[model samples]
Target: MRILIFGAGAVGRVLAAMLSPHNELDIAARDPKLSLIEREGIFVHGAADRKIWPGTKPQGIYDIVIIATKAFDIIRASESVNEFIDENSTIVSPQNGLSHVDILTDYFGHKVILAPTTIGATSTGPNSARLVSLGMTFIGSSSGDMDREKTVAKLFDHAELPNNISNNIIGEVWTKAIVNACINPIAALAGVPNGTLLERNSLLTIAEKACYEAAEAAIVNHIELTHIDVFEWVKEVMRSTSENRCSMLQDLESGRRTEIDEINGVLIKKGESNGISMDVNRALWTMIRTAEGRRLP
Candidate 1:
């Protein structure tokens, strides 16, 4: 099956290479990055494997369309690349935080599949990725179609991006959202890696509070996730990528737009809708946004 992977950033590059051996994989991205991939091939270095993509973009109707971009870019990227997708296509989002499914479903229709990949990757340079870690990715459909979810699961296993088929994907999404809510902003704000918070309970409490509030907000939307699950998941994520910098921190360091607005900011908005005060998350959101603003101007 022909597959088109949008983004070509760290996550996208790792995904493209991981699936390269089993299918016809194409990396569709910005010009310079695309040009680099076309010229030098994408070099993937890390835990499970390493390789180089020496050529070509996939053509025609893609059987699987994987989007690995940040949450903020999902809509515009989908709209811009609509021509590459046909009715038979199954779009998978391997992005972090919640709301990817709703946004994709709104634009790409109900055929969209939600995914959260734990395949940790980092870009050492433009159009280059290192597959630093391994973890299970979840796949499911928001429209409650088992067939679509199954198709995505089959491909994920085929490509060796370890996956679990989830009936409670909304909950899975929010679980990951809660984790990102705690880790991403704080990591960026303090300019530290995930493990840096391990002993910092004073600051860690701030993160924990945000997780509790976000979990509560998620429950209001019928996304059932317990605070314990949130804490355990975040702890696991930290241990997994203990040394790596978060994507949000990477964005801040690079002076690029961060997904804080989508991750924690999404939770803040959800809290508002439910008449819940996500004051701590809002405060972190404000801190990250201020950092983001500094880079912009």
Candidate 2:
């Protein structure tokens, strides 16, 4: 398969490394990292060690276009790669949150696939990353096309990456988003790793409040999450990636904008639309935005 991945960040690099050996891979990224990838190739360390594909700018239409950009950059990433999409091209977005699906569907129509992965990875440098934890990835269609879902599942299987096809990907996406909404901002604000949220009672309390709020919002929105115990799921993730700094924490520490709006802020908006109170989410959203403002010039 010919694949083009946008945003050579942690997850992008990880996916590129995973799929490069089995498929034709191209990475659409900005320089000087682009030049570095072209020169040094993508290297994975820690849990796995290998040199993946050398990055290149995509030209012709590709079999698959993976949007790994941050939620805020999805529009730009999709537009930038629009020329590379054709009728047969399958666009997969593994981005965190719900809004990217709407954006991708709007642009790519029924060709869009929603892939939400729990694999933990962190970028060590421009063209290098470390795998923190390997977890199941769920691939499915928002439109419920089982054949297309199975096709994408086969691609992951061929690459030896763990994945499953789901009839309800939107539910899975919401479940992951709820977990992210609980842990990410709390970790960022506390300046701690994921496990720390579970370790500290005060922090865990905050996360629990956010989790239930998000759960209520999901219920109101008619999203049937697989996890009956959301808090337990969050705890499992914290334990699994104990030492790993979440994406939100990494963004804040590096002085980059965090996806507070897409994660927590989105929950808050949904809560409002559903006539539910998301005070905890609202508070976390405000706090993170304030911290981000202070980090700015």
Candidate 3:
């Protein structure tokens, strides 16, 4: 199968390396990055203990396009993939945040599969990614058809990426949203890895409270996520990914725009639309932006 990955970032590169062994893999990204990967194959460092780069262009009409861009880049990235995607093409997004599936569905129609990956890998340098935990990755279609979803499940399974298909994808996405609501901004604000706050009662309380507010907002939108349902999942993620800093925090450190506008900011707007208040999430969003400004010219 011909596979193309958009955004060649940490997650994209990790998927490229993992999938390249079994299928033909091609990666596309903006600017010098793609040139680097195309000219010298993708260089992966840290974790997995192997520096392997697949040296071939994916031929024929791409069968699957996996998009792993930041939430803010979803629209442009999806549009860019149109050249390669066809009627049978399946697009999978392992992006963070809630609006991504809807955004891709709007652009690529119902052929898209919504995936939330906790296959913990971090990018330590340009064109380099480290495999950390390789947790569960879930997939399903927004339209609830299982054909494409199952195809993706078996694809990842064949590649040893550890994934499954879910009928309750909205709940699954929102569950990850709840975890991101707590971990991403808090990690950015504290400048610590996600697991660091697990021992800090003060930070843990704040995080749990934020998760509560997000869960309530999601429920009001008919999203059906219960804090009781996702509490242990959240705790497990924190414990497992304790040493890694969130991508948002990494973006801030590198003087790039964080996806706060999509994650926390999207939740705030959703809450307002539902007559609910997301003051805590809003406050963290503001603080994150403020901190981001300080790193400016």
Candidate topping lDDT:
2
Which residue pairs clash in candidate 2? none
Q: What is candidate 2's CA lDDT for residue 104?
A: 89
Which ranges of candidate 1 are over 4 A from the true structure? 54-58, 226-228, 294-297
Candidate 2 TM-score over all chains jointly: 0.96
Candidates in order have lDDT scores of 0.80, 0.87, 0.81
Highest-scoring model, TM-score: 2
Q: In candidate 3, what are the lDDT values of residues 154-203, reduced to their tens digit? A: 89988888887887887888888888888899988888888987989888
lDDT of 1 at 76: 80
User: Per model, how many backbone clashes are there?
Assistant: 0, 0, 0
Lowest lDDT 10-mer window, candidate 3? 50-59
User: Order of all candidates by lDDT, from best down to worst?
Assistant: 2, 3, 1
Query: How far off is residue 25 in model 2, in Å?
Result: 0.4
Report the lDDT tens digits of candidate 2 across residue range 34-59. 99999889998776677976449678
lDDT of 3 at 294: 40
**Residue-level lDDT tens digits of model 1 in 210-264:** 8788888887877776345677778778888887788888899999988887888
Tell me the TM-score of each prediction against the true structure.
Answer: 0.94, 0.96, 0.93
Is candidate 1 or 2 superior in lDDT? 2
